[model samples]
Target: MADDYIIRTEGLTKQFKGFVAVRDVTLNVRRGTIHALIGPNGAGKTTVFNLVTKFLEPSAGRIVYNGDDITGSKPADIALKGMVRSFQISAVFPHLSVLENVRIALQRPTGLSFRFWKPDSVLDGLNDKARTLLRDVGLEEFEPVMAGELPYGRKRALEIATTLALDPELMLLDEPMAGMGHEDISRVSALIKTVAKNRTVLMVEHNLNVVSDLSDTITVLQRGEILAEGTYDEVSANPDVREAYMGTGHD
Candidate 1:
């Protein structure tokens, strides 16, 4: 069973100055599945992402990715191992053109030092790759536009394109829909589903509507612990999950 899982955690825990943020939580994410982590405020959803991405060291537990024990590895190292994350806020070069942001990200997997001597023509191949990624994310027409000049939704799409440049196997997205208008949300939501076709996606989402539509499975957390885990219908009808988020059909 473990062999079929792309990301597996055993008794994962994180603490800050003796305050436990994530408890002993064991999780299994099937390969090529869009597994969502949902919860009310302060449930440690992002903390788990930080721990898995190695942005934070766990107080205790083991993190296994692709059948290897990778507990406490550096973020760069984890990313090189085919795991990548996107921030809640847009992470792109504000001054650079939309295409340059993705071109720079494509440079990472090459392991080449940033050299002033490298001619622009040397990166022609990478720029082509970046162009493909931009098109994949629906930014082909905006490639020459300064990244910051694009609309917020397109900026988010650019960041997703940047992550795709890494060619990740497992992707962690933290609230990919935060602060978006309805049209922006729909666009990003469709982009997310397209990206997940070839990768395993584990996301922390507050939009229950997105969860219902995009998630292959859902894990509901409450007060730093898991309340329920199942399909949308299964977890939605769960007494504990409904009570924690909504009060006994009051809404």
Candidate 2:
């Protein structure tokens, strides 16, 4: 909230029984910028995400979004505030056509009662907007394709389109490049850049190359705490980060 930051966490910490997974972390994600969270395994990158998304509650700390305190808010509550997370507990029906998947997402904000139960024709009115979203994500050609049948990278694109349907001001992605081949990685990386033009993106990704190329700011974690924070060059040049990755031999 301070100085255009869309989300900020102060003194964030989490523990399981007696073991701490995240500790006294303070992070700020600037609006309309791509921020990456990176660390070796067990560094608590995912835990920080889980806490922010409200999938897990922090043992101590506060989460602020757009200058409002949302630490005690529910997952749905934060999502409604335009902080939609990719892989957002929203299910994409595998059997549905890609367009249909996006259409469902487009219908989410209506708060209509059992609207999905209505006849399929009832959704014709939304096709244009859904198609526009498809075009926005480069999934226009695959609109008719079954979501389950699309190639891996295109499927990720569709998932992004669905999230975009909610019109989020801030987007959180958990491993946007996970399980991607070289080609898919490039494609999805480009798509993420395109989609992030007017929106803020916060992602947890292991592909440091993608982070190097895409992140406006990078935050590095180690043993459940922040070790480095800066642009790609700064974080990559940090001796502590080099030691954490190479000395510990964690990929």
Candidate 3:
């Protein structure tokens, strides 16, 4: 049963300058599931993400990924272990074409990373694979376009394409639907679902509608602790969860 989970945190906690951000949290993400972590602002959602991804060292507790204890691992180390994360902000090279951006991501696995001096032809081998990833995220038409020239939603799609190029087994998405209109939210939500069919996803999201539609399970955090976790229907009906998250008018 333990092997069913791709990542697990036991008694995870974080402190900043004597202030506790996450406290005694034990989270489990099953393989091949879309799990959403939702809470109001300042609920330590991002802090939990940082701890799991090794962006910030846990003040106390342990993190296990794929049966290995990785509490003391660095961010890059986790990434190398098939755990890749995307930031809340769009993180694409502004000047690069969409195809070039994904090709760059593909380079790391081929031992060509940072060898910018290698002739452009050296990277031509990566183009077909990059184009396939672009088509996967519905950006095949934008491959020749500049990443920065994309509209907000398209840029997010490009970011997903680049993230996919890394061949991540566990993808951590931080606020993937922030600052979007209704249409953009619908588009990206569909993309997340498509990409998550085979791999696992753990996302920190504020949009309950998106969470309800896509999440296989939901974990609700409040004041740096898990308030409740279950299906969207189960947690939505809990009075305590309603008061702490939905009652506050958070969608």
The sequence of per-residue lDDT tens digits that candidate 1 reaches over residues 85-113 is 99999999999899878888888888755
The reply for model 1, stretches above 4 Å from the true place, is: 115-119, 247-251
lDDT of each: 0.87, 0.88, 0.92
- Which is superior by lDDT, 1 or 2? 2
Instruction: Judging by TM-score, tell me the better candidate of 1 and 3.
Output: 3
Superposing all C-alpha atoms, what RMSD in Å does each candidate have to the true structure?
Answer: 2.0, 2.1, 1.2
Candidate 3 lDDT over residue span 1-251, tens digit each? 99999999999999999999999999999999999998889999999999999989999999999999999999999899999999999999989899999999999999886466788798999999998999999999888899999999999999898899999999999999899888999999999999999899999986566788899999989989999999999988888888876555344
TM-score of 3: 0.97
Instruction: Spell out the clash pairs found in candidate 1.
Output: none
Candidate 2 least-lDDT 10 residues = 242-251
lDDT of 1 at 233: 84
Best by lDDT: 3
Give lDDT tens digits, candidate 2, residues 43-110.
99999999999999999999999999999999999888999998623347889899989988888887
